[model samples]
Target: MSKISKLFKGSSSSSSSSSRSKHRSRGGPTPQEAIHRLRETEEMLTKKQDYLEKKIEQEIMVAKKHGTKNKRAALQALKRKKRLEAQLTQIDGTLSTIEFQREALENSHTNTEVLNNLSFATKAMKKVHENMDLDKIDDMMQDITEQQDVAQEISEAISRPFGETFDEDELLAELAELEQEDLEESMKSMGGLPSVPSSKLPSAWHGHRTTTKKRVEEEDDMHMLASWAT
Candidate 1:
């Protein structure tokens, strides 16, 4: 009997869980529905407040009309007015609270929408940045620069002057031969030039040297005459 009871309890618990899961699958009321409900409540509370206010005003008029004419009637009317006033005050408080609740709900709903938009924007930005990498960008730029340099070098090579080519040693040999021929030509030209006579010294220079030699000879003769006189 105990085992059968345990089995029944397990079956019941399983069914309850399945039912709960089914209930969970059914969606709850949305914020719009909740806000609508709040508005309905606010409307009801406002109507109640209006009714209480009207009733309080009617009791006041009755009390004023019966004033001093029927003291007991006036007193009873005033009492009724006070009770209506209290009810109106309570309704007013209820309406204020309802309005506050509705405003809070609206703010919450707006915040939810704003948060969703921000989340979407964040996801979009993340996706945009996903395909970008600093390292890859740097490598790509380097490859581009290298390609540009190679293109420039190729362009420069293609734009070279189309002139004769010469081997270095051959060019040097040719240059030496040309220089030798130039020297030979210069020597031939010099050979054809007028020659200076070996004895073509200036007359003043020759006179100066001859005058010096004669003065030395005269001095030697004077020395010989002095020796004879002695």
Candidate 2:
């Protein structure tokens, strides 16, 4: 570009910069500084109000002291007390206004900070999700759901019965019945009692029976001796 144009641009830029600085300076104090100033003013006003109250009380006492003995002095003292009370009232109003302003400033500062944080969070979220979109998310979820369904089907297939099934309870019941039959048969066989012979027998029969018993005993002895020898 031409030298004249460049010089003009430079001057314009400097003027603009100065204007911005001036505007910034004229924009007044920050929220915190303003709030601090307001609070200080409130405290000063409060102290002044207290002083005025005390002065008013003193003036009342002076007026009471003059009572009717000195009506003009009493009137003057009462007037001074009224003026002090007015001053105190004005201070009270001023302090209220300053407190309200401080509170408003604090709230505004808090809102601004909250907005800044939200904006930062929004930017970060956008940066993190820059390459992501709803379509991809939906597709991913669909794939996950499909995989889960396949897994569920696989699990079900694995758990399905592959062989013939029978009622084990019925088999156990039949086995129990067989065991009961065997038990009953064993008990029946064991329940038999040998018949007992009558102690009194005819002489002839007894002599015969004794002979037979002797013969059987002799055979048993021979068999036992044979077994021992072998």
Report the C-alpha lDDT of model 1 over 88-196, residue by residue, as the tens digit. Answer: 8887888888889889989999999999999999999999999999999999999999999999999999999798887899989998887667655654654533343
What candidate 1 gets wrong by more than 4 Å, as runs, is 1-27, 147-230
> Against the true structure, whose TM-score is highest?
2
Error of 1 at 117 (Å): 1.6
Return the TM-score for candidate 1, rounded to 2 decimals: 0.51
How well does candidate 1 score on lDDT at residue 99? 88
Backbone clash tally (model 1): 0
Which runs of model 2 end up more than 4 angstroms from their true locations? 1-27, 149-230
TM-score of each: 0.51, 0.53
Give one digit per residue, the lDDT tens place, for model 2 in 1-230.
95535654765686567557756987756677667657765765666676778889899999999999999999999999989888888888887888887898999999999999999999999999998998999999999999999999999999999988989999999988876676555445555323448687899998897788779656755654454446
